[model samples]
Target: MKIYSFRKEEGKKITKYDSNFIMSRIIQSEKPVHVGCMHLEKNGVIGYHQAVVPQLLLIMNGEGLVRGERDEYIKVQSGDAVFWEKDEWHETKTDLGLTAIVIESEELNPDSFMALRIN
Candidate 1:
């Protein structure tokens, strides 16, 4: 699993036509993709499983702990994105709650768009 950032602080500032906004590019894929919003209540869990395709989970609200093949959980919150390669083992659970946008596809290349999370 890899952690990335989509926080406004890491986005490119848009100054076109006197517009004021920061655009955090998420993904650009020629291949098909699946996008969905996930809501997990307090102490909710998404059981461990192999990703059928590459997956990107963008934390939009709340926080959680995520684990990959190594079984080490990492804390993640809003604006944080987690990428898991196809067929990689992974799991996600939250002690409080979490709301995220999940994008999945066989051609995901998050590294090409988003930056790795900076400690």
Candidate 2:
């Protein structure tokens, strides 16, 4: 989630900064927000843990497997964002590698901007 993408097919084209850029509006939090890049190297894993607050994991590069609640892993790749509610158990792992941006906040609501992922 360190270097996510707009994918060209997603997000709206922005002409303000540059004509070739796209902007994907992610979140607008009234509460304090915390954002960071996560680097999971080959065979890396993020251990299962309960989220203290709502969290959004934005897959930036590579591919990975993630499980939440039901213990079933879902394949995720760049341009995918996964959200976990407070107190929810979740984990992430990769065979090759992946990087993603993690956003955490009590007021985090990704649905306001990004489409819900059924998986």
C-alpha lDDT values of all predictions: 0.94, 0.82
The deviation in Å at residue 34 for candidate 1 is 0.4
Residue 112 displacement (Å), model 1? 1.0
Candidate 2 yields a Cα-based lDDT of 0.82
Q: What is the Cα-based lDDT of residue 77 in candidate 1?
A: 99
Residue pairs whose backbone atoms clash in candidate 1: none
Q: Tens-digit lDDT track for model 2 on 19-57?
A: 777778888988899999999999999999999898889
Lowest-scoring 10 consecutive residues by lDDT in candidate 1?
A: 110-119
Tens digit of lDDT per residue, candidate 1, span 1-119? 99999999889999999999999999999999999999999999999999999999999999999999987899999999999989999999999999999999989888888999832
Mind sharing the TM-score for model 1?
0.95
Against the true structure, candidate 1 has what lDDT?
Answer: 0.94
Native-to-model Cα distance after best TM-score fit, residue 106 in candidate 2, in Å? 0.2
Count of clashes in candidate 2: 4
